[model samples]
Target: MADHLPPVAREPAAESGTADEPGVPRPATGDSGLRRTGARGASGPRQAYAAIDLGTNNCRLLIARPAGDSFVVIDAFSRVVRLGEGLAQSGRLSDAAMDRALAALQICADKLRRRNVHLARSVATEACRRASNGAEFIERVRRETGIALNVISAQEEARLAVLGCHILLEQGEGPAVIFDIGGGSTELVLIESGPAVPRILDWQSVPWGVVSLSETCGPEGADATQRAARYQRMRSLVDEAFAPFAERIAPARADPPTAESLRLLGTSGTVTTLASLHLDLPSYDRSAVDGVIVPATAMRAIASRLSGLSLAERREVPCIGRERADLVVAGCAILESILDIWPADRLGVADRGIREGILRSLMATGLRRDGAGALRTGQDAV
Candidate 1:
């Protein structure tokens, strides 16, 4: 498809920032007294922790606290900037695209500052990894926003995604397929069953996604047939690349009568939007859509509906709002193509991914501050 997409125990710290007021106190890790109020009386729950994801298409921020095996979401921000726009053709981040992305990052920086995030990690994915001027852009972002963006390699990207969204596989009947469709590239990781942790047998990253495919196969202001052909072409390319992975997983058998069960888990915008449409929602609701199982038949029907709509028409759909209208269909194509190769009864949707993974890793390493309120300096969280 065309488009892509932490708690601690500590004396909960407080923040003065309000750019994007989070709903709950920043989740704390370890054992600490949770001070809901700020230093000043009347201050509400405010712990300071932040994670930033600068992907091919958007800049997103999440501030939350650790809650048992998972974390509860507190404050969040997401805006599409298409940081990797035209990156495939030029092999560089366009100035206009960089500007668009940086603007969004500015807001993220502001939120981080306001929240006084003690532990923050900001990462850039495929587009930046492939860009000739990505290092320069990173330096510029540091100079302007004081937030450096780490351009992660494909391997790390796959691993982190698995860490964040693996919960979807926990309840599955068998091994699951997880993929992320980004603006400049897409990552596919295969997971096999295990009680301790699902094993990641192999992973691949393709330097193609919505923006690249749209530019490569779609016409400039393409007509219906052109768009359809573009989608088909994109699907074909993905299918071709996916064959080897399919072969590796196929031997697991139609019904493995082992101690483990399996299912399909998906993150990225593609699965989320499909889940949203499965509910025929009037607006996006992560709580309702995420972690919900969408039948394979329903998934196909929704993709067909998206294929029939124009960019403008797609925007009209409650689930495919203006922000994601263009990219969702491309994402749908990739998901559908992947499903065609590997069929499963139901696909589990995960709203959480890299950011959650990052936070979880940090907390596990004791890099996170305790709710009682002291930062534990130690080994690297990564």
Candidate 2:
């Protein structure tokens, strides 16, 4: 959501080039490593770590320095590269999509170079994981941008997402369902959160993200009557995908929490967009939207109204620009399906996720060496 960041997935480091899972190994680092800012007249090296998430729909980077207990942002960048634009049917990434993604990675490479990031990790999600030439594209990125992008599994993606954004879960003992509606796939994690990072008791990765769904389902209908039929079809598609997951978790938590204890948290473009519209923001404001809780009924109303509108009409809405108008409705469809499965009264919105998880994982070691004991708590200026 623009330059504004979520109170990031307040989790830890991740790894790539080493494991199929997201781990905390150096991502964009050269042999030189990060500069210990003694050269800058600071007591310790102004070491920083970078995490890039090359999702099907967006390319996001987060650079930060360790704070006392957590980390603080230094510099960040994100772009709508639409890497999975047509992968649903083609089973291969288009040249245009790869080019857009490569261009964005180059920008990230430049930032990591300028910041002298010590340890970093970059990951590719559903788009790359699904593409036939995904490996070739990763090699090209390495040669051109010098950023090794690891195409992680849906399970790893789900784990990292939860690792990054679980902090936003409402404080209740009852199991909370945290979902990340991504571009090509949606990750739903059932968590038993404790004092520390949330535990993933079970998780599911449904292959119905905005990009893939729109490509398959087509338009949101031209009029209200058609729109209703289209919406039901979309809902049914998602519902079927979710049915297996529902059965698996159904009996696990046989004694479900009451309305007061259950929490539904969503971290994705769809949820944020709906929250922004519900708040009547002329434009997206991460500060106002991140970690904000909105009533499920309000979000349902917003999605219904959006479902009834045509593509051109959706483009008229403030944040639903040309790039997102078509896909946002698909996202709404996914959100509505989730709401039906987990009837939480209020939904918590998270702006942070994958990147934040990487930072937290890497910082587990970086924090010990950050030397900026004073700078540990805040590095927003860096």
Candidate 3:
């Protein structure tokens, strides 16, 4: 199945940070007193917002409330359904994949309803962009689940990805390279520094992603050398596609103007799963993984380890279960190639992405403000 998660029960405490104990929900920042007080016409018990990402491999949901300068996560869900499993070979959306995605969307709708989310945005990524019958499937979702899904463009995808991972830009003399490896495509954006705003100097969306690569070039009963060569060939393709973008950002590399250094910030299934594996955790742990840096060498080492394993052996790795074992290597190859093209001391890991970007944009706009001076839109709100 294409990676999609059908909606499930809301767990408020898991995101709030107070529910550190197993099975308890975390205390969300919405309950914290740190929310900005100056927004105009804003009055409320507290505004609840939601963001949903329907990707090629998974469907994810995150609900949150504004906290200080940043917001705190309140509730979250993610499921892998492989919505783009055969999109590379078939131009049309597969009925089976749509069913999986639609089911997941229903769950998201239920969660949004249960959370009483006042403002929300849900986006469909590469799979939806490429499928010939993608629109029809979207209409079906709205009719069946009462959820509106926006099929975002690749450019918008890169922009939202930046918004989600901008925190990394603040840490160093940064002209950071940000990329997301999705199920059907990969987005790479190179941000160059300005005194006031960092500009995206170059961006590209490569059609090859985990889903496509796995389907197109996966081992599939091949000999060991053949599989290795296929992996290498895929990596070379990614490298070739990335060349133009790299050259465009070449000037920034020679003389990074900012005090903060240029680094890579990755937001995708591949990097996050790798982070989980790095910690050797059975399940994903945001605290242990997010914001951590994996050196380029270490990342290659991890990929090397996985490349050597058989499918079953790869599944034995903590972060990559059977569901992802087949595609993980493809993802790793893409990441490794990107990093090798522009060697960075550290590659930042972000569990957050487009969803967080949407919420940040919404609250900043006071779209959910219920009273005067309560949640007035910020100047930065787009």
Q: Top model by TM-score, which number?
A: 2
Off by over 4 Å in 1: 1-47, 170-174, 193-196, 220-223, 253-262, 367-382
How does candidate 2 score on lDDT?
A: 0.77
Model 2 TM-score is 0.85
lDDT, candidates in the order shown = 0.67, 0.77, 0.71
Q: Give the TM-score of candidate 3.
A: 0.83
Could you give candidate 1's per-residue lDDT for residues 98-134 as a string of tens digits?
9988888888877666655556667888888888999
Candidate 3 structure quality by residue, lDDT tens digits, 154-226: 8877777777765644345656788888888899888765653357877898888898888877554456676
For residue 162, model 3's alpha carbon misses the true position, in angstroms, by 0.9
Backbone collisions counted per model: 32, 17, 38
Model 2: lDDT of residue 30: 32
Q: Each candidate: RMSD to true structure?
A: 7.8, 7.6, 8.9
CA error at residue 183 for candidate 2, angstroms = 0.1
What is the Å distance of residue 120 in model 3 from its true position? 0.6
Write down the RMSD of candidate 1 (Cα, Å). 7.8
Off by over 4 Å in 2: 1-45, 252-254, 368-382
